[model samples]
Target: MEPINLDKIAFQITLHGGNSKDLAYDALKAAKEGDFDKAENLLEEADKEFNEGHKVHSKALRSDDKENRIVPTLLLLHAKDHLMAARSEITLIKELIELHKKID
Candidate 1:
């Protein structure tokens, strides 16, 4: 019956978000070059990282950290930004895959 630390959760989430964004960027680059398989592989890796970040978020929601939150910082905002970017990239990747399929 203990609560998780908000600072730690934010740190882990930020790391995962950054990694996922990097993978997604690589996926987009590969897709643009017509390397569909490489793109798919990169996207898969991004999905794994994103899922990890999501787990951290879920932990925060389940714990008492949400209600006891103190000051708001920019780094936490940056983490949210990174997560949004990753999700947007995921959507774009799906579109790219569909486009490639159409071209084939």
Candidate 2:
């Protein structure tokens, strides 16, 4: 396999991550308001975006050694922030759905 350039991969990952975060936020909003189908669709879209970032991440992992890790970049920090938000949204949505189920 060809090695991924750290700089280029980081840019792509960051964009996808940011988009995924937005989708996740929307998903959670829809879920909270009992729009389960819309919420599910939004979550699926977010997962697709997350998977794109995961692709870049997997490439980085494939290309890097412990001693050769890429330097920290703002893009990476932004990506991490988005990833954190998305993960949080997924967890919160799951809980919200369960609570809704109980209420119904």
Candidate 3:
């Protein structure tokens, strides 16, 4: 297999992660406004973005496994941070949406 482009993978992860977070926040806003349909749609989009990021991350892991070593870098760290944050935000937002529904 061709050598993996770590930089590209990092950027892709960051991009998807950031998008997921943004969409999740937007979903929360929609829920707050009592637009549950829109909120659900936004959450779906967020899931898609999160999945894309995860796929890239998995590819990187596979590459590392094949090489039998891990390469740590600042960009990769930042990308991972974004992914984790997005995941957390998505979970929290889903719960908040449910709460909003109950309160509404």
Candidate 4:
């Protein structure tokens, strides 16, 4: 089997996760401005980006399982942080958008 490029995987996760988080925030802003259509579109885009990052992370985990172990690294840790933060922010932003709609 080919060796895993942990750095590349981590970078991909970080990139996609960060994009997801940024997009989610933008969605929230659009919702607050009463642009529900734009907000929903942005949220969809954010979900796609988050899925891309999650796919990369899952692949790494699967590879690790097959190899019996994968060494921890600072970059990997940071990538995981981004992944988690993006997920949480996305969920919260969606709820906030709904609340904004109700309030408006």
Candidate 5:
């Protein structure tokens, strides 16, 4: 595929990844405030955004032929970094939310 196309996908991944992370953080905030229902809803929204980002990343990876893989550019790497960090943040925040629920 063209580099411009790859850049577009990378930008999308980063955007969705950032959205996911923000939603996760919002969920944690809601949990801290004892609004468990809202927290759960936010968590679901975050998961959806995360999945969208992951799908774009997967599509970018799969777009390449077997003989020649997609070249990872700096923007792509940055996007991946955002995605992984968001994933980890959401996972940990889920645990933290559960703990908060138990405490409450």
Candidate 6:
């Protein structure tokens, strides 16, 4: 539970979460442009990034269990926030993509 290691994991979570969010937005943009194939590809990419972030978050949680206690930290919380926001955005973007396709 070195501080530096925790910081690294936190930063990784944030980075992957941001990447997922960005990919979802790109998917939405493609959908708006009526490029369904591209949109689907982008969405898949987003899913992959989200999974990566989730894995990091899971590892952090497991690490805490091994340490026998939870250490509350702002960076960890921020990373969790980013993960949540990315998940929400991806869900909404998926629904919007479906609606846009129907409209098209």
C-alpha lDDT score of every prediction, in listed order: 0.77, 0.74, 0.94, 0.95, 0.94, 0.91
Q: Tens-digit lDDT track for model 3 on 1-104?
A: 57777789899999999999999999999999999999999999999999999999997887786555668789999999999999999999999999999999
Quickly count the clashes in candidate 2.
Answer: 0
Writing each residue's lDDT as its tens digit, candidate 5 over 22-103 gives: 9999999999999999999999999999999999988777777776678889999999999999999999999999999999
- Name the regions of candidate 6 deviating beyond 4 angstroms: 1-4, 66-70
Clashing pairs in 2: none
- On residues 29-48, what C-alpha lDDT tens digit does candidate 1 reach at each position? 88778888898899899999
* Model 4 per-residue lDDT tens digits across residues 1-104: 78888899999999999999999999999998999999999999999999999999998888886455789799999999999899999999999999999999
Between candidates 2 and 6, the TM-score winner? 6
Clashing pairs in 6: none
Candidate 6 lDDT, 17-61, residue by residue in tens: 999999999999999999999999999999999999999989777
Candidate number of the best lDDT: 4
Candidate order by decreasing TM-score: 4, 3, 5, 6, 1, 2
Which regions in candidate 5 have their CA more than 4 angstroms from the true location? Answer: 1-4, 66-68
Clash totals for all candidate models: 0, 0, 0, 0, 0, 0
Show model 3 residue runs off by greater than 4 Å.
Answer: 66-70
lDDT of model 3 at position 79: 95
Model 4 regions lying over 4 Å from their true place: 66-68
lDDT of candidate 2 over 1-104, digit per residue (tens) = 56446667777787787788788778767867888888789888888998888887776766676657667677666766766676666667667766765675
